[model samples]
Target chain A: LAKTTQPISMDSYEGQEVNITCSHNNIATNDYITWYQQFPSQGPRFIIQGYKTKVTNEVASLFIPADRKSSTLSLPRVSLSDTAVYYCLIGGATNKLIFGTGTLLAVQP
Target chain B: SQTIHQWPATLVQPVGSPLSLECTVEGTSNPNLYWYRQAAGRGLQLLFYSVGIGQISSEVPQNLSASRPQDRQFILSSKKLLLSDSGFYLCAWSLGRVEEKLFFGSGTQLSVL
Candidate 1:
């Protein structure tokens, strides 16, 4: 499984955009980058996923560079309700899915 | 319209006691089910996974054991609980073939005192 590295925490204001980047230098060719949003006391929810380039969904957008070594999760128009821990995971099946300490985005008023 | 359900939202068990956690999926058949544990301020650890009924694969060898009694039901059990077992346990399901996005259920929070 590929290990991901992300910032410990980030602060964003309401109505502003937030971008959390994850680095997976050893990402496999068949690996897909997936981002999940986890609120305290509940299960994590799938936000977006992408193999390469960029993919957008109703909730968020994922931008993957050509190398695929790193991907960025962009959240547009942040709100207080959006404040939660965001996890970036790589290599879903070939190896067991491992979660790393994610970027804790605190949306401020 | 698939949904996963996990029970015992919160559990407090004493050391050396028995433990059982149940997870069930509706609207999907023969899905891959998994058991994961999340520690405080840490990431999720894959404890067990099952591809089919009576088929189980364990990622970490420890006090916990998982069983898939039916196509859509998975259970986590322990003969004797340990204080170290306190954490958030999550159950998830995905398509059986290969790399599919996993759908998670409401997790169970276990506190062993």
Candidate 2:
């Protein structure tokens, strides 16, 4: 499994765009970048996923550079409801994941 | 549309007691099921996964075991519970698609004393 590193915590105010980056220097070609949001007591919810370049949805966007060694999760117009733990995961052929401690984003009103 | 159901919502068990947690998925067929544990203020730990009925793969070895009696039913069991077993247990399911997202149950909070 490829290990991922992310910030422990980040802060943002309402109406701001928040970008969280994850570093997976040893990512493989088959690995796809996926992001998930987790609330305090709930299970993780998928935000977005991308193979390369950029992929955007109503909730968030995923940017994977050509090198694929790192990926960024971009959230626009942040709100207090968006405050949660964001996890960057590498999904591949095996469909297995090794989750590291995720980045906690605290959105202020 | 798929939904996952996990029970007891909350449980309290004494150390050395046996444990059982059940999970089921609906509105989908032949989906892959998973069991995960999350400690307070921590990330999730994948405990078990099932690809099909009666097939289970465990990520870590401890006092826990899993059984998939039916295609959509996954169960986590323990012969003797330890204090370390206290945590939030979650059940999830995903499409067989390699890149698909996982849909999770509400969750179960297990307290071992």
Candidate 3:
């Protein structure tokens, strides 16, 4: 499993865009970048996943740089209900899925 | 669509008591099941995983044990509970492989006194 590093916490207001970056310097070729959003007292929900370049979905977008060393999760027009912990995981079929201390996003009014 | 059911939603047990938490998946078969524990203000820790019926893999050496008796039923048990076992337990399942996206249950909050 590739170790990931992210900001401990971030602050955002309603209608603002929030981008959380995760650094995985030793990412493997077969590993994929996946992001999950977890509200308090609930299971983490899948937000977006990408192998490379950019992938957009109904909820969020994932941007993977050419070097694959890092990826960013972009959430547009944040709201108070969007406050949650965001996790960035990098793994392949043969690797163990480990969830590290994720970035806590506080969406204020 | 698939759904996972886990119970009891909240449990408060004595330290020396035995423990059993059941989790079942509906609308899917031959799925990979996993048990994870999360302490307050901490990340998730994978405790056990099962690939098929009667086949289980333990990720951590602890007081808890898991069993897969049927295709869609996963059970977590302990002969004697410990205070350290108190945490939020989550059960998840994936369609085919471990690396695939997972669907998680509502989770159980366990407190051992």
Candidate 4:
């Protein structure tokens, strides 16, 4: 499993865009970057995934550079409901994905 | 179009007691099952995973054990609970081949005293 590093916490106001970056320097060639959101007392939910470059979904977008050393999870026009812990996992689909202490996104009113 | 279910949303058990928590997935076949433990302020720790029925892979030597009686049913059990076993337990299932996405059941909060 490719370990990841991310901010412990981030504060953002509603309606503003928020970007959380994760560093996985040891990412493998077949590994993919995936982001998950977890609200308090709930299971983490998938947000977006990308192998490289950019991948957008109805919920969020993932930006991965060619080097694949790091990736960013971009949430556009955030709201208070988006306040949660965001986890970035780097691994192949079959590999056991590990979760580190993720970035806690606090969306302020 | 899949739903994962976990039982006994919250559990309060005493030390040295036996524990059994069940997780089941619906709308999928031959999915991979996993049991994860999350301590407060800590990330998820993989406890066990099963690729098929009656097959389990333990991730660490711990006070907990897991079982898979069916492809979509995963169980976490402990012969004797310890105070350290108190934490949130989450059950998840992933489609084979592409494990990028996981469908997690609402976690079970276990408070062992």
* TM-score against native, each model: 0.95, 0.97, 0.95, 0.96
The list of candidate 4 runs beyond 4 A from truth reads none
- Candidate 2, superposed: residue stretches over 4 Å from native: none
True-contact fraction for model 2? Answer: 0.63
Displacement of residue A53 (Cα, Å) in model 3 is: 0.4
Q: What would the per-residue lDDT of candidate 4 be over residues B21-45, giving only the tens digit for each residue? A: 9999999898888898998888898
Winning candidate number (lDDT): 2
Ranking by DockQ: 2, 4, 3, 1
- Pairs in steric clash, model 4: none
Point to the candidate with the largest DockQ.
2
lDDT tens per residue, model 2, A1-109 = 7889999999999999999999999887777788999998899998999989999999998888999999999999999999999999886667677677899999988
Cα lDDT for residue B96, candidate 3: 59
**Cα misplacement distance, residue A54 of candidate 3 (Å):** 0.1
Per-residue lDDT for A9-73 in model 4, tens only? 99999999999999999888888788999998899999988899999999899999989999999
> Candidate 4: which docking quality band?
medium
lDDT of 3 by residue, B59-80 (tens): 8998889999999999999999
The fnat of each candidate, in order, is 0.50, 0.63, 0.44, 0.58
Task: Extract clashing residue pairs from model 2.
Answer: none
Docking class of 1: medium
lDDT for B37 in candidate 4 is 91
Give the worst 10-residue stretch by lDDT in candidate 3 chain B.
Answer: B94-103
Kindly report which residue pairs in candidate 1 clash with one another: none
Residue ranges of candidate 1 with Cα displaced over 4 Å = A92-95, B97-99
